[model samples]
Target: MDIIVEGIKQAFILLFTLDREVLGITWLSLKISGSATFLSMFIGVSVGTAVALNQFPGRRFVVSLINTGMGLPPVVVGLFVTIFLWRNGPFGFLEMLYTPTAIVIAQTVIATPIVMGISLAAIQSLPANLRLQILALGATRLQMVWILVKEARLPLLAAVMAGFGGVISEVGASMMVGGNIKGYSRVLTTATVMETGKGNFAIAMALSIILLLLAFTVNVVLTQIQQRDRPR
Candidate 1:
């Protein structure tokens, strides 16, 4: 109990003091996760909507695969990403291992399916005749898709939240791909893990607190946008 309280106090101190290391880690975390979520949103929404609207062979199988990917284990993702980025591995000529960019790639892999699955469901949940209605009104297919996406904005926003949440809180993939290099690739989750491993319980707890607060702040802003203009 005392430890927990002390940790909270330390977290505030770190925040109030504008600790450079903590702030840098926090910013990098947001930047990487934000970029990952944005990329996932672009790819996931496009592919998910296409799949939702079209009738094709093996469509069910593809959807099942996407659903499976939503729950893909982070450590497993980390392992494959690490392997692919290894010095002698394919595409290793770019030499991206143990870097922030590598972390972003792993996180993008982690978040894309989550966003894709939710986007697929959101587009599918609309009234069956909605797409036809839009097309019947002289809207082109592209315009119809745009309208449908607009209609599904609320749930799509939720997908953003989920994707960002997943990547921001994950440590395994970041640690594996980033090597948790201080002042470069270090982030709250990896830092917390490192501190705990070194028995710096107070520092670990403080980092954890900061991470939770960061997640909460981002979600709060997103939630506000989501709820705004919602029907009373």
Candidate 2:
């Protein structure tokens, strides 16, 4: 349709000209999502590995919780985060509501379970005897964990992609926590939503295209690394 064509053209123009607003939103989007994904990687990988390798009481319950968390609704996450950050709420003294940092927190909550769940599955998929093999070779517990993690690097990278994909594409939590203030917390997803609400379909489409392109570029790089590391 004419709208799709026009939107594509607008997207091209925005990228080619590096429109300040567009560029700023794009960069902020990356920053917030990237930060969230990175933080999630650390927390998710650690917790997942710990849970996978240990046999604690109520382990299944914990795993069930993590699995449930992976599918949590973004709006629910945003609402809780907002409430916690609101004045007179717990930890309200930090005053992070409606800020980019708040967005990061909400996004981290959204992405953490995704990454953790995938990581749990990845580590669990490893050879059961592998841990014993390493220990038989006199590897320390710490070194054994590190080696296991390295062996599972491929799927762990996939977790990164999934986590980044989840957070970057999510709009609800970002809108609620970010407030979408121009040049401040406005991101690609929120900007697109605002434009769409205002009937600027072309602009909204353009932003959507840009977001897809961005996600694609990052995934391409990750995919290349993943393929390169594949076992012959």
Question: Which one is best on lDDT?
Answer: 2
For residues 119-193, write the lDDT of model 1, one tens digit per residue. 999999999999889999999989999999999999999998999999999999999999999999998999999
Error of 1 at 119 (Å): 0.3
| Poorest stretch of ten by lDDT in candidate 1 | 199-208
lDDT of 2 by residue, 3-29 (tens): 878877887887788788888999999
C-alpha lDDT values of all predictions:
0.92, 0.93
Which pairs of residues clash in candidate 1, taking residues 3 or more apart in a chain or in different chains?
A: none
Deviating ranges (above 4 Å) for candidate 2: none
Instruction: Give candidates' CA RMSD values in order.
Output: 1.2, 1.2
- State model 2's lDDT: 0.93
Error of 2 at 22 (Å): 0.3
Candidate 1 wrong stretches, greater than 4 Å = none
Model 2 backbone overlap count:
0
